[model samples]
Target chain A: MVVDHFEARLVKLARKGDQGAFAELVDLYKDKIFHLAYRMLSNRHEAEDIVQETFLRVYKSFHRYDDKQKFSTWIYRIATNLCIDRLRKRKPSYYLDAEMNDQEGMDGYTLIPGDERTPESEYLLSETQEMIHQAIEGLPAKYKSVIILRYLQDLSLQEIGDVLDMPVTTVKTRVHRGREFLRKKLENKVF
Target chain B: MDCKQASSLMHDYLDEDLTHGQAVELKSHLKDCSACNERFKELEQTEMVLFAAIKPRSITASDELVDRIMSQIPNQRKQQAWIGWIRKHPALTAAAMFLFVMLFSAISLWESDDQLVVKTADLDQVIINGNTVTVPSGSTIAGNLTVENGKAEIYGDVQGNLTVIDGSYYQASTAHIAGEIKSIDQALDWIWYRITDMFTEVAYK
Candidate 1:
C-alpha cells in the first residue's frame, strides 16, 4: 500500500540503517502488521512480539530485500512465516477447556464493525468475528495463512499465493477447503 | 450449472473471480433451483460476514517495544563491523576470543551468587519456588501462597489459603492464619492439586 509520499524514500534510507527512516516505516505499517499477527496468532502479546521481531528482521535483512515488491508484502511474508514456525512448535493438542471455548464461541459470537448496524447485530458480528478467528486458529498452517491473508488482510488470491509461494490454483483450493471447514464448524449459525 | 458444477464454483462465485460466462451460468441455475439458491445465499452470507468481521483492527504495541527493538538492532552497535573485521585477522581474533570467554565466565560467576528473593509485600501473590519461602515479618499475603518443592516460613498473617506442594509448612511463633494451611506430599494430593491448578488457570487466566 502507498501509505505516504515518503514511503519509497523511507525504504531507501531504512535500507541504509537510518533509524529515523526505519521508525517512520514502522509507524506507517505497525498497526497493519499487528492486525495480521494478532489474527494469525490469536494472542495480543505474541502478536506484539512478532511485530517487533518482524521489523528487526527487516532491518537486519535489508541488504537482501528487493525493491521490486511492495514492502508490506515482504514484511507480511516474514511475519506469516514466523507465525507458522511458532504454530508448528506448539503441541497439536491444547487444553481441552480452550477447545471447548472455541466450539462454544463458534455458535455464540457475531459482531459487525460499523456503527450503522444495530447494537445487538454489532454484538453478534463481534462474536462471529471471535468465532471465525478461533476457527481460523485451529486450521493447519497452510490453510490458516491463506485464509487470513485473503479474508482478513484483504489480499487478492494471487497476492496471497505470491506471499505463500503457492500456485493460484492451490490458493483457491485451500480457500475452498478452509471455508468448508469453517462452514461445518459454524453449522446452524447465521453467518 | 448443475448442482455439482454450482457447488464447485460456489467459492469462486462468492469471491467474484468467476468468468462472466461462468457467473451467468451459476446465476441462471440459482434462479431456477430453490435449493441451490438457498445454498448460494448461505455461502454469500458467509462471504459478507467474513468481509465485515476481519477488518484491519489496531493493536497498540507496548510503549517500549520500538525503543527495545531499536536498541537491539545490529546497526546500533557501531563496533560490530570492527569486531567482524577483527575476527578476520587471526591475531586479533585470538585476543577477542580470550576477552569474550573471560568476561562471560566472570558474569556467570557473579550471577550464580545472586538470590531471587521477592518479598510478599511487593507481590500480589507469592509463589515460593526454590528451597525455601520466607514471608517476612509485617507482610500479609493478599492472595493464595503456594510453596512448591520448598519450605514456607510464615511470620505474618495470610489472607488466602497456604498450599505447600511437596514441601513443609512452618508457622512462626508470631504467625497468625486467617486461612487454612495445607501441606500436600502424597501422590493423590499431587494429582488433585494438578487438576485443580489446571481448572483454576483455565477459569481465571
Candidate 2:
C-alpha cells in the first residue's frame, strides 16, 4: 500500500518534469535495484552505476508510462534486462570459486540487525549471506534471474512473470528449480 | 496420486492454482500415503528455511552517485526519443508539432558549455559557460568553453584569455588573471572609465 501510494504521487509529479520527484523515486527504488545489480555483476561500482542509470532512464522515459502497469514491475524489468545484458557480455569465471567483493562497496550495504550480538553469530550471519550470494550467482542466468526477483526483490510470482515476460506457470517451475539448486548448494554448508 | 505425481504438483498445489476437486483428491492422497507424507514434510521444511534465508536486504547507493550523474548530464547532447510518441505514432503530426515547439524553447534557452564557461588556471584556458562568467579559486578548465544559461566561477587563474559573449564577470579576491579578460557586463557598468581610457588602453588591450 505504501509503495502503491508512492507510485501514484510519483507518477503525477514525474510526468510534469519534476526533478525532485524523480529523485524521490530514486531513493525509493535505488537499493532494490542495487541489490539485484550487485548480485548479478558481483561488482559494487557497476551496481552503483546501474542504480543511477536506472533512475536516469526512468526519468527520461517516465512520460510514456501507461500508469496501468505497476511501477515496481516496470523498474524490475529495466534492472533485470540490464543485468542480463551485463551477464551476457561477461567472460566465464576462470575459477569455480570466487571470493566475494566485500571490500568493494564497503559499508554501503548495512546488515539490518546485529546489535548486541556476539561476534561469532555476526560472523556466521555475514558468511551465510555471502554463501547465499555465491550460490545464487552460480546459478544459470535464467534461473538466477527469477530466484533473485522472487526471493531477493520480493516480487510475487505474477509480478515476476510481468517483469521477465514469462507465463506465471513457467515462472513457478523456474522458481522451484532455482530453489532446489540453492538447497543442494547450501546443504550442510558452513564457513 | 503417488509421491512422484504429488511432488511434481507440489508447486502448483502450493500456488493454490488447483481447482477444488483436484485439491480435494490431492489432500485425500496425502492423508493415506506415508512416503508422500514424508516428501511433503521435507518440502515444507525446505520452503521455510529457503524463504527465511532470502529476505530482501536493502542496499544504499554511494553518495558520489549524484555527482557522477550530474557531471554526465551536462554536455549530454544525445537526442533521446522523448516519450517515443514522435516515432511511435507518427500519423499524429499534431504531437510532433508540440514536441517541436518545446524543443525550440529548450534550445533557445540552451547555453553551450564552451560559450559561457572559462577556466581560471593558462593551463586554465577553460571555457566559461552561462549568461555571465567568473573564474573560481583553485580550478582550471583545460579546453575551449561555451556558456548559455548561467554565470562562471573563476577563483584560481585562467591559462587562456577569457571570452564571453554576454553576462557579468565576477572576479573574486583569490582570482588570478593570466589570460586576456573581457566582459560584456563590465563595459556597460564601466562605460565612462572604458571610454575615457579607451585611447590609452587601446594599444595595450
Cand. 1 TM to true fold: 0.61
Q: How many residue pairs clash in each candidate?
A: 12, 45
Candidate maximizing TM-score: 1
User: Please, what is the whole-model Cα lDDT of each candidate in the order they appear?
Assistant: 0.72, 0.64
Which DockQ value does candidate 1 get? 0.20
Model 2, B17-96: lDDT tens per residue?
Answer: 67788777778888999877766665555566555555544444566676565545423313444445467777686876
Candidate 1 off by > 4 Å: A1-5, A95-97, A102-125, B56-59, B74-205
- Cα shift from native, residue B172, model 1 (Å): 96
